[model samples]
Target: MAEQKERDRQEDDRSSPLIDQYTARNPEQFARNLARAMEELGKVAAAWTQAREKGEASDVSAAPIADMIKTFSRVSEYWLGDPTRALEAQTRLFAEFMGIWANAIRRMSEAGIPDHAEAPASDKRFQDPEWGRNAFFSFLKQAYLVTSRWALDLVEGADGLDLATRHKARFYMEQVSQALSPSNFLLTNPELFRETMASNGENLVRGMRMLAEDISAGRGDIKLRQSDASQFKVGENIAATPGKVIARNRLVEVLQYAPATENVLKRPLLIVPPWINKFYILDLNPKRSFIRWAVEQGHTVFVISWVNPDERHGTLDWSDYFEEGIRFALNAVEKATGEKQVNAVGYCVGGTLLAASLALMAAEGDERIATATFLTTQVDFTYAGDLKVFVDEEQIAALDKVMQGKGYLDANRMATAFNMLRAGDLIWPYVVNNYLRGKAPLPFDLLYWNSDSTRLAAANHSYYLRNCYLENNLSHGRAVLGGKKIDLGAITIPIFNLAAREDHIAPAKSVFLGSSFFSGPVEFVLAGSGHIAGVVNPPVSNKYQFWTGAKPAGELESWITNAQETGGSWWPYWQTWIEKQDGERVAARKPGGKKKPLGDAPGDYVRIRS
Candidate 1:
């Protein structure tokens, strides 16, 4: 209770601000932004001139220039060619709001009472007491949101635009609409106004300091989180599950988590996490830690903690990740456990790699995997959700140029792209709280983990995006990794496919498509949450639910119709499934017999931050 009070005080103190201060400084800030943008543009122009003068303006450079111009032209024509269209949309929106108001007033007069309408569950802007208890502001808030929605639809409905182009436009439109909402401003938000008055402008001073720090940190474009580096540390309090790094290679570190039970399964469980982020996501905390839970469930669990890549690691491709990363860990696990067969689990891109590895192993007639579990993994890229908008020939070419310069994709660049996918939730909220309301960021373990992202090697990133996102080769059995063509249908092992219903990266439907390629029995489960929460769900929380069905081979719609709802975590169900696949129970063994314990569970690789 005392800690809660302290947090509340921090929030109130942080949130005190003024519309006056913002309005007063708006002109100066705009001028500064404009000047910096012009300076950057001038630098680019100078570089282009220097390149041409030095005879370095080859066809490669010229092609990107030409393509960029073409894209600009097409986009300009789509939105700017019909200037009257946007104005007409605004007019129509005003007319609709007026009509709504008139109808509401007439109904109230006839009924001789107030007629209140419920707000949409997704819209929290009008949830404030000022908007809900006050009928006038309530109607105004609804009208504003309705107009915002209509404006977005108008932009998205532009004719002759590609799906990718449409999505990109809508994304920006939503950002602007969300930012300009009345709830974000101090003058409009009654609660914020009250706090500002009470604090007597100290929040504004603190907010300015916060803005300056962000500018210093080179993340002024968007304030993603409020917490500083001092807020949390890894391995001590956060990723502190008991384990040992039993094996290590250049590409991966194999973490053998200490068994939490007296008796363990015959087959060990190997986890393949995505190389895009640190592996501690699975071992986040004891309560929500999936690795700790798996160990407690009587499984000899091991996970691969991928190396945070730098320029030197740029040449490493998908094959290196397969052979040196997953395969190396697999070999070490087999040597240590004396178990030929294993239960493999993969999450996100790691899941994709696992599926590919299993297929390649299957092709070699090496059936070492007894059961394969995929969490939010996509073998088929068709309908890959919002991420598809950023993948295309032109986008890939531009990204290549950036990667070639740096030898790897910047961590911030990748983080920004993912944040853009859910701008309303991830991007704009921080913008309002940090910039407008002048509030310090709340300390969230998940957000801290999110901010602690890793870099991707240039060649590895390029190959994965081109082959998986653009060509759709993996699902079609045409993607060649480690000099072998991987066929998903080749793996006939019992599969447990888990997908987040609201996953933006790997849509549930796209994940379900993998089941169609498998010949063996599949138990498809759909968990109720987004990407991270669905996978990290622990039964002790009893929060998010999951749905399971036997008809994994059927269409996604049919499976949903036939699926049964379970009111707890999907971990126990997975435990039972893996138990059936395991050989016989044996006494729990300690880590590192065949291979010596390298260090602690997370290892040195995970500690290397970009």
Candidate 2:
């Protein structure tokens, strides 16, 4: 026993030197880094203060946080108002804690004691081997998992809350649980602890410095770096598809991509991408560029590249978008290609606008658009996913008030909201990597495009929120644009509505439900991925599958059950469909056939950063 004890002591002493060596070798450098980190932190504080003073900081009165508190208060009232219910909740939690404690005791006493709690297999936060192998960390992980599940259960079991309130409570509970996960903390996370010790606290120093830099980049807010921004340039490597800006308007620049084939479809293709994000999402890189791929398929593609709006464009509304953006692009396409009949594609919010525009054009007897395609777009906001949580009346008013001040919503505000929707995936990982591990994220083109957000004009955004999300007017035919009520039924042109199965922004069910509103023969395709990936998926990648079976007449589940699943990208399938609509070939037309070329493929408008 004495010999075993001496051996264990020696092992401990040997391990100590590994950690001690970093401090001994670089004590002065560590001190200097720590001092620099402190200075950066001070700058972060000052920047925050200045932003608040200038009224540039996010409004604390926003409903997300406030509604979370209010909803939880109602939950508390439900539990606390009845002593028995509160006692039951307490007893349940207490029992779980007791079970964990007993297991922990057994673990200390014996060699192998089964965990009393286990995080879900899909939960990446507890993936570290030490979280399960080490008794101390295993206990902490299990305890945290147990407590968080209990908290969520309480919210789920709570009575007397409306559906909206319940949803808010659940979302907020998730946010809190994710934020408070043991892995987020320094000592609680085994990986962070090991890295800090190995580096003699230099990791934290570097992390603090990065935090300061990110805050500065966001202009007082932390613009979480998901990818190395330094690695991407808009026109050089990304959005590098050969094309020319044939037309430019105050709101949009119409880029006509050069044809890759000798002949092209007689009917031109116009893409209306959402202004909330840059058009480069579709043209991220040649490998993933949908625009480039479409051009290679022998189609004249004209994409509307919306200008990142500012105070100057605040007064622009949906009508302006319809007229100056879509209408102007249509007119430009005609002038460039001399084609009156054109096939149009709209993505996300852009699709929503295009649907409304079609309705208005129907009312005005304009039949220029021959066919329409919607990509992960939701006309009906009924099952709009978590985004609806931010669309209540109180929140809209608050957002409007903030937008009114600047004439446009800040890009970061929207980016943060989108990130929050998938906080477990998009947010906390970056928080751990960039700020905890003190490591720079690797360069990823998709992530770089995601980070490049765009501001929304005040009038346009406010109208969209009130009409689409708040009222669900577009689906119901109550949406008014250009002084005409929007009736999706009036859009009798053949429609191709694509919905991502895993879409959060525009849920598949929502899109399926929306397909029924169109009087045309709507072919709803369910792609097997999220919003961006499912749409941007090229045939060469063969990454995800897509489904197509029946018209979206029945429940989404029934359609999904009856649908035929096909492997590989849906791009070729869509191309076949487009050809079926109009297969007539014409000599490949040059960009800006009649009009003067404004600039290169990704024009000056896309170069504007928010």
Candidate 3:
């Protein structure tokens, strides 16, 4: 036993060289610091001793009391006199338990378990008392691990110590690194993060969001929607292209996309796309573009393409979109195909514009819209998500001052706002993955498209926020559109409204509110993904699941319940609804047109970025 003790002491002497190197730069200072830490740890030992003495006086098993006292004694000795490896082992065991608790938060969040924003934190946070054992233990373990890693690294290439001591230092260091890893942090706020505006809470939430980006969380196992097609032909194209372009703007380049089939519904179809973005959302990729589906289903499809604004078109506003957009497009479509009336489908902000156009058209006794499909669009904006908290009288005033100098809102600014919304998924995960993990981000097609953002006119954005969202003018029956006093009651068309269950941008409840203004029959659908994915869903993948049952009781609550609960894209279901609305025809028209030449039905605009 005496010889074994001698060997152990000899091994300790060899590792002393690395220990000296680490503390050499400030040996006296480090020793002083270590002494202070030991003094504090000794206090913990004293309390554990008191508890043990009390337990020993009783008939109960004092084993738990004895163990805790030993742990505190071990920690106190290491920081002061001994500085051995055994203390670190106990610290690590305690830390593993806390880490298991931290990761549990994310699992709970993904499962939609509501957080206790109002719940008080555990009494373990009372650090001045013995109750703080949990917090104190966690802090101690974390520090121990950090020291262990550096100590291990120090001994890795050293010449002196036996293999076991070197291994002890190395193992502790690795264990410390794992304990201090950034992944161990929780990625959430008190749920109040969503309600925060210009406060540091927003910053905290943004920081958490940045940490929880899609990449950091690991690639989602959910499949993406895909489709396969062998040929492309509008049934009417067999003989000649039957679609017509009523209007074409060299200045705006807003091509009107409309098709002519064998038996057109008594009324034609007109589309309104948001100017903040180009109109191609209705005509995205071939297999899933709403316009492509519309054409194949035998309906006349017309889409408006907005000219991407640069330094030149920056001055454009609400009037230009009305007179030159809807009015011009309407006349052109009417003259080209000679249709007396047409139905309209508007998406996002475009639907708001469509609301104005319909109100004005109705006021003028020029009611032509037979039915309208507002896909994830909103006319009422009492609660426009986090977008509301960011832009109000003050923020808009500042933005207006900046935009006035440039003549329009920079597209990059719009991108920045959206980036703030999903900062976790869209922005920061890559930062951790790159700087800390030493890896590049995975290339995701949706992220690529999201990164491809566009600018909107300053006048339009300012007007849109103040009049539409902040003031809630459209829904209040207190706005004007195209020289007509606006009244939503004037909109008398069959309404098909849609939104998504998980859409952070346009929550389904808000979208469902639009039904209140309309006296006509209304149908609302809530899809299963976020904003973009839910809208562009395709049946090729079961990634999307939809509900299509009874109509919602109140557009909001019913929206949550009424979804018939179908899996995959809602595209096929939408097509079926369209076909059912119109009578059937035996033959489809030929593929050509007069003075039109069937020049690319969707046109080249759909192929370009905003």
Candidate 4:
């Protein structure tokens, strides 16, 4: 109760400026708002006695709305007066009052109720239909309609309105972005979501993707880790979950939680971290930590911990990522495990780099690599999922402008971009709760983690877009890497491929396309989830599903023909294939030959930040 009081106080404090804003500078605008408030107060008074006079077509029929208006009287009283003194006060007060009503509408919308989708709240078609429609009172509708009209007037630069009203309108539309506001209509409707999905009718795909993500989140059983400091010390072991980086020369070090047994066991494996976020997505917690599971399973696991890039790293490109990212990590893993013939597992962008490494190695005839696995990784970007539509000329140009200002893509900018892709799910749900219900949005683990993002080097992004996505060079069995032409056909070693059934960034079929270009025997598995969750899937969390073919599920058509559907995570299936290929449990020892680390395991280049 005390904490709630404190929070309420803080919110009031934050809202105070908005209340006092127009009082001093804008008087004319205040009058319009003052009239609206008086008008609402009059309606409320009538609604209380008249509208509720039995048979007055009551909107306050709902227990919730009745309770809401009973409180609104008290809440609005602070703002509702003669509409005479300091008209600016009236304007500011009305704007703030409207904020409350807007929030209320939003809360009601989040029930996924269809009646809320349209205005005037009649002719209802929500899941609850009859039960939900009659909930709102005609009197409350009158109050809301009047205030909303005032808001529209304020927004349109209406004359005779006080400086505060006009300022509120002009200010919020461009700068305030009532996007998260309880009353925001943008998120509640299917318009925004429909626009994106309209391109491919990816409704089923999106549903599958979200289902997989939920499964992954369930595994994490993840607890929110909040802090004001970046570097945190816990039990003498430093774990860095730096949610974001604002300054230069900083990083979020996701802990590599391998079990004690993996400390010495053979078959060194370096887990490829995706470029989209911190590596902790894979090693979320003890229950969901793939690293912990792999180590417990007796494989010496080492993960590539990437430095959060900044403006200084803007010029870094694909060549730099290979030399310093995968190559550098491989060198360190070799030294740690004392084995040059280690396995490699690539994920998303990291998987692409692994594939690039294979070609780079195959070109040089370096076969220290024993086996390779690509989880939801794509080399061919022709059908690059939902993300492809975003790469259209106009959108990319807008992105270039946005990126130009920072030289490096800002992490939050990326977060916002992706959030727009699922605006209804990620943004609107909270808007409704916080605004209409005077409630707090759900602090979902996935949403919280989704907020954590990382920047990609401008040059690296350019290389990826042009060489891989645009040119399709990586899929043609020909692409240059490490000063030599990389040929996928040259890699005769065992290869494992898994693509997410619901992946939007890189469609499963598109990812499987690479297997067609490879000469080696290929095993492709289609996992049950989307991009991230599909790869991070663990065993304890069953109930998810996957698909695999007797041979390879390469190309959309053939894979569609031969695919065999399965009903559990592909993790166990992968373990069987991996076990068959991995021979001789050579005790884990540090490499002594050319694989020796130049200095320490983490290395200087990786540690290198802005």
Q: Output the better candidate (2/3) by lDDT.
A: 2
Please write out the lDDT profile of model 1 over residues 412-487, one tens digit for every residue.
6678678877777887677667755678888877887887888899999998999899999998989998898889
Writing each residue's lDDT as its tens digit, candidate 2 over 463-528 gives 999999999988898888988777988889999999999998999999999998889898889999
Off by over 4 Å in 1: 1-91, 100-122, 131-143, 155-166, 185-194, 218-223, 226-229
Residue 548 local lDDT, model 1: 89
After TM-score superposition, the amount by which residue 311's alpha carbon in candidate 1 deviates from its true location, in angstroms, is 0.7
TM-score of each: 0.83, 0.95, 0.59, 0.59
Evaluate model 2: give its TM-score.
0.95
lDDT scores of the candidates, listed in order: 0.76, 0.88, 0.54, 0.54
For candidate 3, which ten residues in a row score worst on lDDT? 221-230
The predicted structure with the larger TM-score, 1 or 3, is 1
User: Highest lDDT, which number?
Assistant: 2
Q: How does candidate 1 fare on TM-score?
A: 0.83
Please give, for residues 361-389, the per-residue lDDT of candidate 4 as tens digits. Answer: 77777777788988888877766654443
How badly does each model clash, as a count of residue pairs?
1, 0, 30, 22
RMSD of 1: 6.4
Error of 1 at 147 (Å): 2.6
Question: Lowest summed-lDDT stretch of 10 residues in model 4?
Answer: 240-249
The predicted structure with the larger lDDT, 1 or 4, is 1
